[model samples]
Target chain A: MSTTRRVVIEPLTRVEGHGKVTIRLDSAGEVESARLHVVEFRGFERFIQGRPYWEMPVAVQRLCGICPVSHHLAAAKAMDGIVGVDELTPTAEKVRRLMHYGQIFQSHALHFFHLSSPDLLFGFDSDPATRNVIGVAGAFPELARQGILMRKYGQEVIQATAGKKVHGTGAIPGGVNRSLTSAERVELAADIPRQKRWAAEAVAIARDYTLENLAFATEFAAFPSNHLGLVRPDGTFDLYDGVLRAVDESGEKILNDVEAGRYADVLVEEVRPWSYMKFPFLRELGPHKGWYRVGPLARLAVCERIATPEAEAARVQFDEAMGGRPGTMSLAYHWARMIETLSAIEEIEQLLDDPDIEGDDLVRKGERRPESVGVIEAPRGTLFHHYVVADDDTVMRANLIVSTTSNNEPMNRAVESVAKKFLTGTEITEGLLNHVEVAIRAYDPCLSCATHALGKMPLVIEIQDAGGRTLAEGKRNS
Target chain B: MSESFTFYIDGVPVEAAPGMTILDAAQAAGIWIPRLCWHEELEPFGGCRVCTVKMNGRSCAACTQPAEPESVVENDSVALREWRKALVELLFAEGNHFCMACEKSGSCELQALAYRLGIAAPRFEHRWQAREVDASHADVLIDRNRCILCARCVRASRDLDGKNVFGFTGRGPERRVAVNSDARLRDTDLDVSDRAVDICPVGAIIRKGVGFTVPIGARRYDGAPIGSDVESANDELESANEHTEGGAAATVRQEE
Candidate 1:
């Protein structure tokens, strides 16, 4: 008689939202497949149907507390298109850009040092209780403090420009509602050098650690897949403003310079029965070949140049070290994250130095248009906020494609690859189960942003024998 | 007696003056009854039924009802709260209150009442009724879609500003706020300093060119809930009364 066994991992820890990893084994105890189930559902699109277009930027920020600024700016960008302005006033543009960079700086710092560092600084197999930011703080006090301060500085920058940090209503249609005062500008610029040095040190430490663990880093969910990101007209990395680009595993461009508003023309989303998040893919390639990786690693892979000097140097080393290929190793996300943080810090410094940043010409008036699509390279990846407005300026429809959801297919494949490689027998230890979480964490996928659910679920891992009887389980509340 | 009055609100005895209304006495005692269209600066206009409270087991508008001595008031009961919530839902349904997008969102009394009452969503189906926006005013916009027929603007215009520029027309669902001058606000004797512009409870009467002047998180009601000050006031008053004689018993009784 043949019997099938199912292993379920619930509420993946350190990540934003509740998610489960289910792996089924055949009667022969051979791996069948693995799936990441997003258990929460949020209907932001359905309820926001009758809202005003101008309010979308603020409303959409409610999607994720960790990355509200990304949604704020992306929604504003879409509203700008509706307002029929291609470019904002210089002061308005600089203010919004500063806010965006601040978000990127803080979000990257949060994920890298606070979230990912616990796993990397302390070995993955280390005691779960002591394997966290607290553990990192106990081991490397200065590193942990620097990480905290880095995020604090980023928040300060955000507060100065956008006004109350997270979910600030700074950016609006046509342009921003307020401008940076001279004092606010000085306050932001004052801390740049310290932040810059900290970013550089973080990149050095992350790169060195990644290089030292070359073997495991290369083997951890390392598979060739497509990479996607946004790039400036000159092919430089840009998080806030740019055109989308998609490249194959060999660093060959498949989709280049696609306008942000025209995302639907090139991409499509497919729903799956197992997860709440819909899998997005290239329109032409369909599901199989269409799956691609996003976020820092993908952004680094697609961009040819870094606009800032220090970040450019780090990118060069990163590309060469990662074999000059997109999707070389999933673990390289940490390294690329550090590089992006450096870029964000540099951009913040530059924006602060610009005199126009403190100018008072913040907003422009215009007639409302019928529809708009906004896109921005959020800290995670590309974020899209599309809205249709009636003649009265009330929102008729709202469609959002968050970064984590866009990476749904790639995340699932990565989980499976890690599970197949690591899960050898029936006995699933905490350390072994952590290997699976490490793969999901490598992507730094914000399941909260993806699912948009009301409440969070605890991360759980259950190993079941032949007839789906629980053999072992691992659970963590945090 | 000394011409003073005392009433039991939520079964706790509260002091009041003879002529003071229940709403006024409650305000002096730092007890909050969710209300709209009854601004302290303006005369009582019980157009909004949100402040309906159980007076001796009968429903009455708290803002207009005078405080009667020895009367039992049921202001904070589950059934009364639900009834109030239902009234708020009706208001929300009647008007186009897209709080997420409104300029007066954080400061809007209607939105704050909804938030304070924990009304996450309106229970009733929304009447997506089309309303005209009177942008004829060069400085002010009268978006009828967001108007809740609170009459605060009308009262402010007629009484406070003495312009008598705003009034209500029609009846029931068709009843709407209208400017006195048939032409436009610019043609009327209205300026940037009109009281009606600032008296709107919703986003209906907003000054143009200054939309979203306050950043969202920094806006009113962002840092604290709408009636948090009132709650604090109640605590302060209760503690102050405790410093006086016979306060501890009243405080304990109110808690119970």
Candidate 2:
């Protein structure tokens, strides 16, 4: 008789949020389907209801500790509309951009060095005991130290601009509250050369790892999907504020430069009963085919070029290496992430040199509007914050499309692709499951932000027969 | 004229008038006895009890207890510190402070007191009680979720502003600050310039459109502890006394 069984890997490791994967195998022990399940749920959208509209910028930071600045800026941008100012003062915009690049720099550095470096350095199928950040620290001490210091530098930049490292109140409706001081400028500028060098070295590390394992990198969970991010009006990489653009796998613009306020017109989110995270897709293509990949790889694919010189050069080389096509390789995310890090550091250097960041003309005023939408390219990917304020200035409703939610479909596809390629039998092993986790980690999914929940569960692999009886079980507590 | 008397606070001599409470005497002597509901501009309500101090072997509200002659007061004792810490923690647990996003964060007396007393987080479980916000007023917002029942606004509105715009309602956990009107704050005679708006020790009552204007580091309490100003005044007094003693000793040495 033909036998069908399911294998479940619960609570994936080395990622920001709590999630699991379940794969079903056919009679031939061939993978049939795999799904990534977000296990926690937090109703942040409902939490922000009835709060003052100005509080959104600070209150929404509670959504994700890892990327509170992203939420802060996104909500502030939206509130800028509620206050009816389409453009901010020069100083306000620059300070906010500085804060954002600092966030991107720190977030990307942390992911590459602390989270993903272990897999790249030690190999995916290595001993599960030492296959972590500790392992990376033991093997590549200097690289690990650089990662930590780089993260600290970025955090300092954040504190200097946002007033606090976590849950900053720097960005407010209409404008920012404070400008960068000249002393802060000098202090941050002093570290730019070192940061630039380290960022360049990080890019090299990711690039070398990808090229060294070219065969594995190209084939691992590789597939064509749509890409989405923000791009400057001049078609260059922009992480802070920009018009939204999305392209298909062939680099064709499916959704052109749509203003951030009009994002709801282009994208729609579909909810499934199985997971708390909603699947967001291009409105024109429907849910199935409209699903797209986000984050570093998607940003690189969607943007025409990086505006900074060093990063632009790196992007050129990256494109040349990809044969001038949008790279669908899941592992290539590390390379793109490093390139963006370099770009962020470069932008930070330029902003520090500019005098406008220290200007006192920080706030602006305009007429009021009841509804507004804010979109920005967060460290992970495109994040959207939409709010409808009552005439009394309280938030009537709020809808958030976090980066992880946008990449939900892509991450599921990645898990299935990896499982199909790696799964050999009904019994789940550590090495085989790590392969699945490695694919998901490439997306750098923040399930906490995606599900808007708290707490996490342990990792469990259950082998179930066709009748749903558990045949074998493996567990790893976290 | 009131009769002046002398008392001892933590063994330090403090002079006070007959009508002065222990808190008033401490402040006059440049000693800060932390009190939430004893603003200088308002009558002493003694509601918070954060200023509870042992006077003549009995604990009493320092803000209301009269400073008697020859009275020995025990302030800043370890037991008093812990009791005060618990009181602050309870106040924190009773309200949904949300200090992180509050406009009054750095300048807020409650938060500054918590920092001064080294209360990292409330030990008790948070009472996330549902509360109402009165944003109907054109220029004033009363977010009752942050109210600690200090009654500063009630006192200020009635005594100082002469508008009687705010009052207390309900009892126990249900008790909260209420507007004089049956409905929202807009219906009340409260104005933006009312001292009641500025007298709130927390974000419970605040002027609208003025939140988060001050940068983090420049705020009132960011540079020092909450009572540091009062403590600094004590430092200045001690230095002055030392200078006087030095001058007298110099004169004696010259005579010798």
Interface alpha-carbon RMSD, every candidate: 4.1, 1.1
- The per-model lDDT (C-alpha) reads 0.82, 0.87
Model 2 pairs in collision: A42-A452
Report RMSD (Å) for each prediction in the order shown.
7.3, 6.0
Instruction: List, residue by residue over A206-288, the lDDT tens digit for candidate 1.
Output: 89988999998788888888988889977889888888899998988899789878999999999988899999999989989
Give candidate 1's error at residue B178 in angstroms.
12
Docking class for model 1 is: acceptable
Score chain B of each candidate by TM-score: 0.89, 0.91
Q: Which window of ten consecutive residues has the lowest lDDT sum in model 1 chain B? A: B247-256
Model 2 interface RMSD, in angstroms? 1.1
Q: DockQ scores for all the models shown?
A: 0.28, 0.48
